[model samples]
Target chain A: MPRFTAGDRVTVLDLGKPGHVRIPWFIRHKTGRIERYCGAYPNPEDLAFGRPGLPAIDLYRVHFPQTELWPDYPGPPGDTLEIEVYDHWLEPAEPLT
Target chain B: MTPEPIGYSADAVDPSRLVVEGHEGADYYALMTEAIHKILLEKQVLAPSDTDRVIAALEAPNVTWGARIVAQAWKDPSYKARLLADGSAAAREMGYAIKEAKLVVVENTSSLHNIIVCTLCSCYPRSLLGQPPWWYISKNYRARTVREPRAVLAEFGVAIPPPMEVRVHDSNADMRYLVLPKAPADAAERRFDDLVRIVTRNMMIGTELVEPYRDRG
Candidate 1:
């Protein structure tokens, strides 16, 4: 079972694979708020090779402010960036340093 | 089998200097038909005689659940919020199963705008939506939309004001996206059907916004 839910804060981990990963390249090291919970899905790595019935993974709809994702995002101050991510790609956010 | 004579020999003179690729032979069509038949059989949705009918039906455009949700959102704010908050539940309320297609909704607000793209492939919500536009799958659009969103929108004649910001939503996972555009001015009081007419498919994808049409009379 997934630990995160909508509105939960989490940090995405950096999986050091060289080839294409479904998680956006820009978002690997960012932290965001979960906005929605997409139900269990087959892990992309397993599905890529036609493997069926792969282990179910949690999908979270995360929201990051536009400014956080891009250096030059020109939206209003409160604007947010939202995206769906799988479980393995994220970990609980560390306490503020 | 011996290699068949090359249809377009390099030595042959050609007009217009364009190279025409060889066409698929009869065997290719027969194999394709058989493959389709096997798929239909596995799905157990139709009889062998009904294959032609199914083919015709597939060719015809059908109203999809995604379009239905957009239409409903135009009429009800509560439903729209549900859609933005929890797409699966919102779709379930309208009698659509989330399992049918992975559905996601991107909200367009006063400060931030959203657009959808399937950068890797045309991974659209077909069960909830019919096929995507030919342009949606074009390599040009996929590669360029994320990096140069404003320019792409400009090409589509959509200009973003200085105060407004654009965000490109990449639908690369099994999940698909629908652009929930901000309702046009005075749209709240409009009838549902009239609003649907104004919110064309292009507008739903964020390439255009609903503009009030002038009355001819």
Candidate 2:
């Protein structure tokens, strides 16, 4: 079962990991909504090293507004960037505290 | 005969015209590929005679597989819904089994235009489109397509108006993406074969528009 559902707001975390990570740098720390649960797979970071990477990681398709990602984004307001984000990289957009 | 003016050619001097010649299997990557092939053969991981079959398998699926899926979707709305919901299964329904990654089909609409990219690497829906075109894997195309898609698209003769939302999909994970381009206006009246012809590989890549009558009126 996926931790986040579609439309759930989530923020990507910048763990500053120095390895085969799938998350892109630009989307780090940025908030976006879950477009869909992309199912789970072996952690790429571990897989790169030939590890079994068992207990697959859940992935979600997150959609971020281009304007938020780039303040000076030249495109129209509706422009958006969507990418896959592993579960560990995401936190609830709503403040827990 | 005058010397070619010392420097008649540099990358900046007619940049695209500059050609860097290469031996078929001698480039760094090409050599690396050759080395790996030999290693695999030596290790018994790949049989030397299997090369032809392997290449044939890889080349089997081409743009037509994707175009046929799109054409079917246009003909039957139910298939489109299935494609949007579960791309891999929908593709399998038509015999295009996505062995390596899950296929994710995104649609292009009047308000939203979808473009696919792999910022991390060139992850593509090869099961349907065969090998990705050279530019699809180029670093230049990968970087710019995400940040300034509108401009990059302009390079492909695709100009997305300011009002229409340009949605960029970074296919950086296990899920491969394919853009379900909008059918031409006369798609319904047109024959199925013509409909398939209208949906080009570039259209599925989200860089070009599907012009049904562009080839012939």
After superposition, the stretches of candidate 1 with alpha carbons farther than 4 Å from their true spots are A5-11, A14-20, A30-33, A65-81, B1-68, B92-99, B212-217
Model 1 quality (TM-score): 0.69
CA error at residue B169 for candidate 1, angstroms: 2.3
* TM-score for chain B in model 1: 0.70
* Per-residue accuracy of model 1 over B125-158 as CA lDDT, tens digit each: 5555567888887867876676567778889987
Pairs of residues clashing in candidate 1: A64-A81
Task: Output the number of the DockQ-best candidate.
Answer: 2
- Tens-digit lDDT track of model 1 for A12-91: 77776534467765566778888777788887777776777377888877777656765675444444455668888888
Candidate 2 chain B lowest-lDDT run of ten: B6-15
Q: Candidate 1 at residue B24, lDDT?
A: 39
What TM-score does each prediction get for chain A alone? 0.85, 0.95
